[model samples]
Target: MAPKSDSAEAIVLNFVNEQNRPLNSQNVADSLQKFNLKKAGIQKALDNLADSGKISFKEYGKQKIYLARQDQFDIPNSEELNQMKEENAQVQQQLDEQKRAISEVEGEIKNLQSNLTLEQIRHKEAKLQKEVKEMEDKLVKLRKGVTLVRPEERKAIAEMYSEKLSQWRKRKRMFKDVWDAITENLPKDLKEFKEELGLEYDEDVGVSLQSFSGLLQHGKK
Candidate 1:
């Protein structure tokens, strides 16, 4: 059902006062469409309110822009304005601090990602422990004088082991040569550079080519 003309005028007046902004007849009509007020009725109500000084308006050519009376609102004093400014400054400072804290937390997360996770560390530890256990078992067998190789296979096995060991030494030397060339002009020391690259030598893992040297010959003797 359509609102009566007087009720429509009252609705339009309340809308203008609540919005407290300059609005044309079309703006008022569109806003009041939900109230079942016709566009013509809304325009008529706006005009009546303006004529009665119930709302203020400014004429721009053929269009009139209506606004609520500013004299009805209380203006803030100078002290109140200063207090509002201080409150705004404190809120801004809190926002900046939160941003800084978020940035720091993000940096820490990136740093943790660069290092090994707990699972990876546990996996590596398990592998090293397994290797240690194998070595200990081999030592126990050797102490019991258990024959791990046939007499005929001893020479062949020793020769094969020696060849493989020589190849390993050659590869190690080649790697060291390449590493030296790469790090010749680098600012970091060799140890730090190797650490940064996660590179490890045999000695770092408690094993060395020198320690394995003459193993077969010593056993034969």
Candidate 2:
């Protein structure tokens, strides 16, 4: 019987640690049953174990979800398992926060419904529905570990970057052409002078022709 009790405790610990997802009280009870452990024994063991930070027993209404404390749980060859468990904890926390917020908004919506006229109630309902949709979308993104950027928002941002890149490329091309045209119109005798100055005529004729022509035309000695 002692060995049996030890096996049950190990099973309970491993289940919560392994799943690492939230569940309500009934769900936890169901898991305990599946492990073939008596519900009362498992429940008692869980509660006591939780006090030592060995597990987390979160109560959502009558439902309880048990998660193994990352600090306490261990599995061999589980690389960065602790980090993964911590992330799961954060995700669970975020889910609870979102649920609370939705509940608050629902209460507000109910209050507004009671106070508003029929037409006003219709408007409020529409607004609330829109807000709920937005919140649901955000929740989906959170679950996926992605940030919710609306389609319109992303399109606007992409458009802005595209416009800037187009303009930048245009300016670069213009400057490249201008510089090429500059040396193109260098003085016919400039090559000899350049060679005399020991500055190799590596620029070749017609190099930077446009700017060189503009400079010569505007800056004649």
Leading candidate by lDDT: 1
Off by over 4 Å in 2: 1-5, 32-35, 72-221
Q: State the lDDT at 70 in candidate 2.
A: 69
Q: Which ten residues in a row have the lowest lDDT in candidate 1?
A: 212-221
TM-scores vs. true structure, each candidate = 0.40, 0.28
Query: What tens digits encode model 1's per-residue C-alpha lDDT throughout 9-53?
Result: 878888998999999988888888889998888889888887887
TM-score result, candidate 2: 0.28
- Reference-based lDDT, residue 35, model 1: 93
Query: Residue 191 in model 1: shift from native, Å?
Result: 47
Return the lDDT, model 2, position 24: 45
For residues 44-162, write the lDDT of model 2, one tens digit per residue: 76776677676777777876667767665465466677788889999999999999999999999999778869888799999999999999998898999895677789778667655
Model 2 lowest lDDT segment of ten: 212-221
